[model samples]
Target: MAEERSKVAAIGTFASAADHAECRRLHRRYGTTYYFATQRFPAAIRRRVHALYGFVRVPDEWVDNPAHTNKDAQSRALSDYRAQLLRGLEGVRPEEPALRAFCDVVHEVRMPLEEPLLFLDAMQMDLTVDRYETYRDLRGYMRGSASAVGLMMCAALEAGDDPEMLAAAQALGEAMQLTNFLRDVAEDAARGRIYLPQEDLRSFGVTEDEIFSGVISDRFCNLMKFEIARARALYALADIGIPMLPPCAQKAVQLARVLYSRI
Candidate 1:
């Protein structure tokens, strides 16, 4: 029984040991890259990170999987999941292991409830908005999906309300998310989602068909180059904030930044 508890120390009893165990399993199975970086964290922080990842990942899988039941079913699943999280945040124990574990961390760190809500809103957006017409449009989506998660992490790490740190964390989150979009362009395209901005494609003389057809035209290469450069710039911005984290946390976040930037 004790072996099934969280690997992180200082995890009291807000969530049952089984809840954290399930959260940890979700993180390890689906969040391979983030899970790699998480190992560098102090145990206390690592488990909370797992809980957070599990929380976001569950709703994401509900909507993202190509074989998902249907749009309405996915939407209903997300809504129901959000309701459970809301109850959990209000101090009622949730039946879902992921929500219960994440709520435990939220209460422990005094994280603002708004961040998770924003994340859920972004997930909701995924149901209806599959293609972004412009970089600005994509940024609007990312503000909730990526930036909010960064802000939540900043709170968890106790960055002490520093605007610079907050900005850097958001930049890092955006950078990582952009990297994922780049790496998964083919997969997301297969799912009928196009995260790359339409304007960028037009500017580079690439077309939706070219992306869908998986062509490696010079224009497509140029467009990818431009986006990769933009992602790197965000990573550079994130570097400025790493030093602001608690001493024990700096290494882990820096490693994550470095790993994602390499992609």
Candidate 2:
């Protein structure tokens, strides 16, 4: 009995170690900026952050993969991924390495099950929605894709349920996501998706055709400038939340915020 128990414990230890390594690899490969910023965190918190990135990256890849030509296939794949995540969250070990690691973090932090579910919903939106009519409409999407991520990070840092901190975290998430949209305007247009609000395009006298053509006209430049200003404002708002985090977590969050804004 003792030998059998030892063997079982060894297997569990190996699995946990392997899952954490896989999470780190994924974060390093696809999330260079965020991964680097995580260096500021203590070892335990860094591992959880890596797992979080791995979890988010998997679903994001499902929607954004260039080779995924069929929307139906992508939808089905996303559904399967969501199912696997749900199972993992329910205490079943997920087969996928990233999901396994993420499940461990979820259990550790007691992360809300709804947060990952909401993120999956946003990825599903990418498959069906191609444009936003207004900033308000875009924010609805960000609530899932970005805001949930911030909330998850807060849980990982053990930042507690401070309402003001949560609000600022949401703002930080929006700021980073908006910066990404601006930087990837041409790339996203190539994929037949435009994250920029249609109303803003109209106001700036910019057209979808111009964006598709990669035209850097004064109008397009002006529109980008306006977006940059808006993102900066969010960064300012999010800055207030950093101080609310534990001393160890604050530096990492601040570094990520600064690095994303530089993008």
Candidate 3:
């Protein structure tokens, strides 16, 4: 819990961003310390991370936004959002306010420009495709969406070239994503998004119909238990990467791991 506490401490700094104000607000809405942690980074690193956070906030907004009617609109919005982000990174003023501040972080960190954009690719997967056929499929989604962000953050700390470190960071990111999948199954299905592997559900004698029933059965509980167990495995793998980092950042990562997997 020490690490998670540090993340909580860091999240407190989010309120200071006047320019990327809405992004900060959105971060708060989804559970910041437990979900996104640029605010939870060390003070020296916080602002750049805040920009990363704001950049990330855009793709998330496009997916979770109520205004998105179907796959086409979502894809177009995400495509445009990503392009605008690139322009902002290149020092051009963006039409979107979120990208404006997000670009500042991009310049400040001088991070590998490919990471946050890869994250956009991940969310685009969510908007366009909802059914996962197997663990392999799910893992692919996690890699793009969450693992890419983790690897990029490692780069932010200048660990980009270190394959082992990035691997661990990716594990942590997947763990965080898996936790969200468990907690949000009900909410996700209501919105026509189902991330649980279809094969896993079938193997365990569960069905999509049961999921829609909203009734918690012994089978459903068992299914959740299996999913949580899988997420925990990823958390354990992520733990292998935490100790290699300097203090505050390590603590922040650990904190997010614990809180996100708390259920």
Most accurate candidate by lDDT: 2
Model 3: worst 10 consecutive residues (lDDT sum): 4-13
Q: Give the Cα lDDT of each candidate.
A: 0.86, 0.86, 0.71
TM-score of 3: 0.85
Task: List, residue by residue over 1-90, the lDDT tens digit for candidate 1.
Answer: 232111222333468888888888998999887889999988989888888988898999898888895989989988898788766655
RMSD for each model, in Å, please? 6.0, 6.5, 7.5
- Which is better, 2 or 3, measured by TM-score? 2
Model 3: per-residue lDDT, tens digit, 196-231?
999988988888987876778888889989998988
- Candidate 2 residues lying further than 4 Å off, grouped into runs, are 1-15
- Model 2 steric clash total: 0
- After superposing candidate 1 on the true structure, give the runs of residues whose Cα lies further than 4 Å from its correct spot: 1-13
Compute each candidate's TM-score over C-alphas.
0.93, 0.93, 0.85
Question: On residues 1-263, what C-alpha lDDT tens digit does candidate 2 reach at each position?
Answer: 23211111111211378888888998999989999999999999999899899889987887887887799999998888877776665556677888888777777767767777778889999999999999999999999999989988998898999999999999999999999899999888888999999999999999999999999999999999999999999999999999999999999999999888998
- The collision pairs in model 1 are none
Where model 3 places Cα greater than 4 Å from the true spot, the runs are: 1-17, 35-40
